[model samples]
Target chain A: MEYFFELLLSGLTRGSIYALIALGYTMVYGIIQLINFAHGEVYMIGAFTALIVASILTMLGWNEIAILFIASVVAVVYSMAYGYTLEKVAYKPLRHAPRLSALISAIGMSLFLQNYVLLAQTSDFMPFPSLIPDLEILEPIAHLITTPEIAIILTTAIVMVLLTFMIKFTRVGKAMRATSQDREMAMLVGVDVNRVISITFIVGSATAALGGVLIASHVGQINFYIGFIAGIKAFVAAVLGGIGSMPGAVLGSLVLGCAEAFFTGFVSSDYEDVFAFIILVVILIFRPAGILGRSDISKV
Target chain B: MLELKNIKTFYGNIQALKDVSIEISEGEIITLIGANGAGKSTTLMSICGIVPPRSGEILFMGKPIQDMAPNNIVSLGICQVPEGRRIFPFLTVAENLDMGAFLRKDKDEIKRDIEYIYELFPILAERRNQAGGTLSGGEQQMLAISRALMAKPRLLLMDEPSLGLAPLIVKQIFEIIKKINTENKTTIFLVEQNANMALKVAHRGYVMETGRVSMSDTAANLLANDEVRKAYLGI
Candidate 1:
């Protein structure tokens, strides 16, 4: 029972990170109907920026809180700028093109970014500074929520709440929902559709960068290839949660994280991906639209 | 006032509107009538810059706006209630209406317009919190028009507002259109297939066939013309 509780605690901690990253995928997909393949690179860029900024701040004798704040700000801004540039240069021109072309472009962009990062910052894994103090909340029964875990979960929950509020109560959020539903109608009603699309990318990438920083802080090391697996996992979480549903992504990430924990703990670490695939297949076979996904019937 | 002179619109290889020239004076309701695919909706779309004319001039209040973007056009006091009642399905009726006035900065005015929209379409007011997709066809149509009105546009362009509504509901919508015109003095350009009903409410009308403006006349005169009545009204 203690072991199970420990697994659940760790599962939730990792799930928080997945949820934050999945939000980036779900958000961009919701508004643009395009899978931003380069989103993972945004994560990688965030981790590297945080690493550089934290090291600089530490060298300058800054305290933990100040370094964390500066690192987060720089990482978020850099990621948002990268996301904006990616959309303007690659996705914007292919806005009306076939889905296959966009998907290919996204893959190409992912590869290019991976190589660019590899060339710029050596292929070695770099140790990241821990921002949160490792405070244990439970007695040594082999499992208790640590400070990083608590921080990840709380921060993700808060961000999700703020995002929900924005989407529900703000005018820009309404415009985003409008543009997603019917682009032409939104434009006719005086929505700057392009600007909304840009904002979606910016929001998605910024959150992804934050996720990168948090995950790096938790694990203590990151590399150029760090985003690849995390990105794929987050994409899976987004799909499992129903791609466009915000709450769905969170739930999906939790379920996925739990599944991975169980697989790693009981079966084997190498079999984690196999378990993920099997779960995805089984879930889709039983519920094709996903746990919370609604079937969309196209009307003329 | 809105004017389109020598406007030509094309969809790939097919031309949808050819040299379609017309004028809609402020404080008047103008209608364009045609058969299926006769460039009626295309005309309205061109005026709002949805489908820009290949070679022509479009003037809004004597200012050329042929190359303006859709949002910019709306900012210039032009808004559209497009065909098929394209209300955001996931949004509530209230949110859908809010999107219509997205460019406005005055909070009080937005609230007042929303209340007025509720008064105009009481059923929508009752369903303000319901998802737009759940509304009946006629109700959705009403919401669509009210959403456009939230923009407080100087010129409102409506396409096929009565396309799928019941006859009684169609009558109700036309009555509301007339009321809006007289009460707000909003210049309206209506594209419709219901020639008989459109002519009954419009001051002037244009007849389009096969991507060309086949005829143009005063609404009463067009209603009496043999060609329009036989081809469109089935009278």
Candidate 2:
């Protein structure tokens, strides 16, 4: 029973991180109907940004908590810039082109950003300092969960609550809902569709950056290739819940995370990824539209 | 209120409107009647700056607006109720009305306009919280028109409001269109396949064939013209 609780806690931490990354995937897909394959590259860039900022702050003898917050803020700003430019250069011109063309451009972009980072920084793994402070109060259950894991779960919950509030009550959120359903009509009603698209990219990139920074601190090292694997996993989560549904993405991530954690703890760790894919395939065969995804009911 | 001089619009290399000259005075209800693929919607879209004319001038209230963005055109008090009554399906009826007033700044005025809309279409008020997709076709049409009215436009452009509705519903909508024009004195640019219903309300009309305006006259004269009656009115 103790072992079971430990595995569940770890799975929750992992699920939270996946939720952060999966949101970007789901939102971009929701608004533009593009998979945004370079999303992983954005996460990689965020991690790299945080590392560089933290190193500078540490050299300046800043407090550890201060370094964490400042580094995260800088990383978010940089990732937003990258996301904005990525949409303009890679996707904007192809807005009217075939979906395949935009998709290919995304692939090319993912490769380009990876290589750019590889050349600028080394391809070798870099050690990352733990940014989340150890909470003395939770020391009673220290065996079951770590401070970094607690930090991740708490942060994800806050982010989700804020995101849900924004989507449900804000004016921009209303425009986003309208634009997603019928873009031309949105234009007719005076929505600046291009601006909405930019905002979506910015918001999505911010969440991915938060995920990147948090995971780097938890894992103790990053080679950036981590983004590709983590990104693929999150994409799987988004698909599991329903590609375009926000709540679906988080639910899917939690389920996937728990499934992997249990399989690794009880069975062999080597088959963790294999087991995840098998679950996805089995679920898809039965529910192609995903757990919460409404099958397309396009009206003529 | 608006003028299109020698306007030529193209979708890629294929022309949709060619040399489409038109003049609309303030407070007049003008309509363009044509068959499918005859460039009627394209003309409205071009005027609204969704598709800007390639090489010509579109002057709204004597200001050159040929190169403005869609939102900018909308800010100039030109709002469109596009073809198919393309309401956002996921949005509730009330939210759809709010979206129509997206560019407006006056909160009090917006609220008042919404109330007016509710009064104008009591059925829409009843379905205010319902998702637009769940509404029947006639109900959606009412919501679409009300959504446009929320913008408080001096000129309203309606595309095929009568396209797919029962005759009784169509009559109700046409009556509302007439009421809107007279009550607000808004200049209207109506595009429709239902020529008979349109001409009865329009002060003047243009007949578009292929991509050109083949004829232009008073609405009553066009209704009586043998050529228009046979080809369009089915008289």
Candidate 3:
């Protein structure tokens, strides 16, 4: 029973991180219908940005709280810039091209960013200092919960709430929804479709940056290759919930996270990834449209 | 008022509009009618800058607007209800309407326009919260027109507004189009395959054949012509 409770708690914490990253994937896909293959690298760039910012802040004698906030902001800004540049350089030219070509371009971008980072930074995993204090809560429940876990859950929830509000209430959000639903129609109505697309990338990249910072703070280290597996997991989560659905991404992440945690705790950690991939395949075969995706009838 | 002088449009190498010429005077409803590939939609699209003419000129209100972007064309008060009633399927009816006024900043006026549009298409008001994708064909057509009207365009371009509706629903749509033109005095450039319905509403009309203007005359004259009646109206 105790093991079960501990696994559940850990799963929820990890689920929160996956949810944060999955939001980026879902959002970019929502607006532009591009999978944004470079999103995972944006995640990696965020962590590196945080590392640099934290090191600089610490050298300047800043406190832990100050460093964490500043590092988060720096990561978000850097990742947003990277995402914007990626869209302008890679995705924009292929706007009217075949979907297969864009898919290949995205894969190429993923490889390019990973290799670029590998050359710039060390290929090996490096330690990232713990930015948040790890609080051992739930002593009565055998310390089933911790402050970092609470923080992760709270931060992810807060961001989700804010994002929902933005999408529902703001003008820009409406523009995004319009562009996503019908690009040519949106342009006819005077919504700058290109601007909305860029904003989508920026928002997705910024959220991904936050996820990177939070995960680094939680896990304590990262490598240039860290984004690949995590990116695949989040992509699965996005697909599970519905690629263009915000709430779906969060829901999918939670399910994947809990499943993986239970599998690792009871069955074996070695088979953790296999479980996720199997779930994805099964879901694809059974419910290809996803839990939240709308079924589109082919127009004759 | 709008004028297209020897305008040519192509879909890659295949010319869709070959030296097509027409004029629309202010507050008049002018229509282009023909068969499926008669280049009717191409003429409207070119005016809205979705498909710019390869050669020749389009003058809107006496200013050349041949190279403007689609959004810029809308901002200059030339708006289009594209073919297929291309409503944003995922958006709520109200949100879809709001998108029509995306370039405008007048909040009070926008609200007034929304209310007016609802009154014009009361079914749309009832379904304001519904996703656009779920609307019936007639309702979607209504929303497309209402969305275009939200722009308060000086010139309204409608492409195949009656393409896929029941005959009764088609009558209702044409009635509304007539009301919009007479009441609002907005210039209308309509592209349609329904020749009979179009000629009934248009002050002047053109018959397009194989990417060229086969005939241009008063709507009454075109309706009475033997060639137009046989080839287009199936009379």
Of the two candidates 2 and 3, the one with more favorable TM-score, higher being better, is 2
DockQ of 2: 0.81
Candidate lDDT values, in order: 0.88, 0.92, 0.89
Per-prediction TM-score: 0.97, 0.98, 0.97
Off by over 4 Å in 1: A136-142
Candidate 3 chain B minimal-lDDT segment of 10 residues: B42-51
In model 3, which runs have C-alpha deviations exceeding 4 angstroms?
A135-142
Which regions of candidate 2 fall more than 4 Å away from where they truly are? Answer: none
User: Ten consecutive residues with minimal summed lDDT in candidate 2 chain B?
Assistant: B82-91
Which tens-of-lDDT digit does each residue in A77-182 have in candidate 2? 9999999999999999999999999999999999899988988887899998899888899899899999989999999999999988888789899888888888
lDDT of 1 by residue, A1-300 (tens): 767777787888888888989998988888877888889989989999999999998999998888888899999999999999999988999987898898889998999999999999989999998987765443353246677787888999999999999888887888888888888899999898999999988988988999999999889999899888889888888889888888888999999998888778877999888887787777778876677776775754
Q: Which candidate is the best by lDDT?
A: 2
Per-candidate DockQ values are: 0.85, 0.81, 0.77
Could you give the candidate ranking by DockQ, starting with the highest?
A: 1, 2, 3
C-alpha displacement of A107 in model 3, angstroms? 1.1
TM-score, candidate 3, first chain: 0.96
Error of 2 at A139 (Å): 0.7
TM-score of chain A for candidate 1?
Answer: 0.95
In model 2, what are the clashing residue pairs, if there are any?
none
B101-164 per-residue lDDT for model 1 (tens digits): 8889999999998988888778888999999998989999999999899899899999999988
